[model samples]
Target: MTYPRSLLRAAVLAGMTVVVLVQFAAQLVLMVPGVLLGMVFLLPPPIHAGRVLVSRWRRMFANWTGRTVPVPYEPPPPPPEPDEEGLYRHESTLYKSPRFPAFFHRLDWLMKDPATKRDLSWAFWFPVLGLLPLALAAGPLLLALWTWVWGPPWGLPGEPSSGAWWATAWTALWERPAWLAALSVPGLVALPWTVGAVARWSAWLLAPGVRRPPSAKRVEQTLLAWVRCAMLVACAAAEVVLLAVSLACFGLGFGLGLVFLIPVANSHFRWLANMRRQFAEWGGVRIPRPYTPQLRPELRPDGLYRVKNNLYKTETMATFNANWQWTWNDIASWRDLVWLAADPVVTVALVGAPVAAVVYGGWGLVFPWVWTELFDADWSAWYGAVAGHRTLGLLVGLALVAAGLAVPRPLLVAHAWWTALLLRPTKAAAAEAALRERVERLTQTRTDALDAQAAEVRRIERDLHDGAQARLIAVGLTLGAIERLMDTDPAAARKLVAQARETSATALTELRDLVRGIHPPVLSERGLGDAVRALALDTAAEVNVAGELPGRPPAPVESAAYFAVSELLANATRHGGAERIGIDLRHRDGVLRITVTDDGDGGANPSRGTGLRGIERRLGTFDGTLTIHSPPGGPTVATLELPCALSSPKTSTS
Candidate 1:
């Protein structure tokens, strides 16, 4: 059986996280120097540097949880402008002279920021909170490994009996040490749940979004309930047939029949359920599993009684006990037998007819000739030897040939409809399944958002490293050369200085462009509406704009919305093939809606290119929706809606 992906994720993440946790503990050592710097020198560069390292830790936490954390520290106020002589003096003065007021201000701002504290808290507690699930997922595999390698030679911890041979350990599991094989079953089942759960817990703490659309979720649940119904019916029908076989075998084979009645019936029921689940899945329905919570071994009366009885309790014997009620409770398995028995008879024909046609129609013609030639027998002997000699032999052969040519596509269609009838889930199950799917989707998009942010940061870094930073270094080198040449070659010094100035100016412009590419300054300074209007000013097409939110959204949402519009406008300009475009923005009832319409060639689809899909995926992170309505030969309209309220005490500006 395949393990659930959640368990695999939990196991892997937990292992890496354990190492992160150790590093996380080590990070607290930063506080010692941080406080030391805070007390002595107010404007300490080390303190800020330490925080930057901690921000990386915070990002790791966010990634595991599938939530993106925006860096909270404000960008340092722009450096003082140059004087008329083109000299920058404020950088020297801000830190050099007299009072430590600037230092105090910097320290105070770092200490006061809420985001800083959130990061610190997350670093310390995430390991504690996340480790339990991780352990659960990883524990079974570890135990199995121990048993497989060591338990065969020597029994576990206290057992005195010599362990079984390695050959019998797994294959002939019933003879000795069968529990080793048994251990693997629970291990596979335990691990797959933690992936989404960890993600949800992380999101809740970091950046919880809105609930899924109830209507859509409810429909999914309904579909799941129907699948359960199908499986139940199949299980019941299959069980009935198996039950009769079980009794018949028991009557004939006696004690040896124990294997038939239990294993045979169970295997058949399991197979039916598995098939139903697959069929339902093929029809785009997720079967809702019946949730069962187990009683803890330590707290359960059965465990306590066994302990009190010195582990010699005969009544605790698991098998060879009468428990018809236990069997009766397996409603799901039995219910599936019914569906299995009724599983669209047409499905068998749908699958079988073509196979028959291939087997006989393709291979049929040669069989008779081969038999006749090899044995030196005539057709009459091959056909009439089995049935008394008659003129009907040729007709029988023709009928057999005709049967192979049958193609029953209608049966295939009927089988599909039959599958659809049973696999649809109920409202509640659909809602629950929808939530699971949404959680998985939210986690994915959150990861994408984080990745996008990281990519942007890297782009900015590269621009500085290769472009602006390199330019600045060149300028500094030129300045040093000019300084040395000033007394010796005045004209050469002036010419070099002028080139350095130009280099500095170019680097500054590149820096500004990098910043704008990340999050436009216009979007922050003037709200999304005006920011978009500013964007349109540079576009080639004629554009009209309307509507505005009363206040700004969270920084991340605003940034995503701005880019979403930008992407749409770009698509319109490049591929839209139109002269005019319209933009509308409206915020009401805690949702921001943006509509972009272009009088262009209509047939626009996300599948045709990455741009539209990229916009949709970006908006999806904020519990947002993107709808595109474009028909051939006309106008195209795209609408984006995000579920976020504009109620922050201070408007967020990125």
Candidate 2:
């Protein structure tokens, strides 16, 4: 799914505003540090590094502020590329953001200010120093209030007749109405000062001419800016609402969200924050998700699983075909089963004698008489010693309980590890599914192309025999009659000749139309470049083509490409209501990429449109693939990729 640049900008700006507001508000209490920590993990390495520098300086400033405020900062390391995988250092929940480094860096740059420095020391220590009293008093004052209100007299704790003098004294001292007033005073002053400093920094950071507009201009722009901000805020709100709904759904059903729900939620929040900051900086906004966040887990045995049953069962094409999904069974292969067994630790534990001992001890304790009868010991004495009010026995009993709980953890972990190890091959089967999918896609595309060609051939043959050819045959018959009649009667021969000419013209026109529909003759004579231009010129919508083609391609290749463009444009004009279209064709690294983009009412569904289906079919003949990028918006792009060398078009001029 994709969003329009304008609405996307607005959504981003709104998110930035929210992040800033939340950060500032949290600073008033000590919640800012956690949020900052979360943000730091969300941001890119460079911005995080810059923030670290700022943080250190802020701590220095805090020391001068005559207050102790630990301006904390932790710089994240450089990010891994998109495809790299594995757990992160620190076992950080922050790592959950699949695109963390990229996402956060964009956000940090958007949210950063020169006024705060790279470390953000000033922002941190300033808040800490300014709100030190409020921060320090928060815990004790709450405790004092709790005691004063729900003191011993109000509860059944020692049943005190009245509130303690000390409790009242402490409450009066720390929880005074004046302190609340004092707490608010710093915020009022700090708000404007911080805002101004940040604003000045922002003005300096942007290009010289890119200053915030003057009062009059601001007033004029306020409405639009507000609208943008509102839209972006709505996007953030939508994210939160969707997250909650998804969580609720997960909880109600199989609880797929349980294993990684918190992490997913955190990652999503970070993503939204990053998105918002970028938008806000650019004076843009983002909109709520047009499509639902439907992330079904890809089946993997070792990785997180969606369901328990899918573990043992193999994957089948039928499993995926029903829902257009590739299931665990379909991808699961015998080769991966060996890795599965080797990876799981279950066998090792089951063979160990220590595990058996622990299990026997627990079972024997449940019915001590059985052990006593077997051992010929005094069960009652042993039970009394443990249960009686005695020092050694009581301690021993507690130790036994502690040991019972403690011993199980490592053993359970080992068991799970072994089980998972045994299941490694199954997991490998799931992981290899992507490779299988790539192969299948190639095969399917080629099959589709063959089918399309067969259909096209049948169509052409039908048109020729039933239409132009039959008409031409009649013309030939008329000419033959005219030739014979010419010797007998010249006037009659002239009349027959005129009738043959009319039939000849009609047949010629029909043949021309049929040829044009089959594969435009111009495409074969000129090449893809001129063919596309011609096709675009015929369309009502504006077309902008970019990229240079090197020499002419094979006839079959050019024709297939031309037909694809024609079909896409046809669809755009007939159903899309698109005003403008962009066609980009490029040959890079020995592969041909054809991209067709349109700005119109989006939400184009491939399943519902034959034009797109035909494009897919055509590309399939060459083992090429079509990818649709359409959301409910004003723009959509359809991309076609083909292996130039592997797929040569098949056709017969005859």
Estimate the TM-score of every prediction: 0.41, 0.37
Candidate 1 lDDT, tens digit per residue, 189-240? 6544555565555544443222447986876655444344444345445646
Backbone collisions counted per model: 38, 50
Stretch of 10 with least lDDT, candidate 2: 284-293
How much is 600 displaced in model 1, in angstroms?
3.3
Judged by lDDT against the true structure, how good is candidate 2?
0.51
Best by TM-score: 1
lDDT of each: 0.60, 0.51
Q: What is the C-alpha lDDT profile of model 2 across 417-445, one tens digit per residue? A: 43333222344444455466668887887
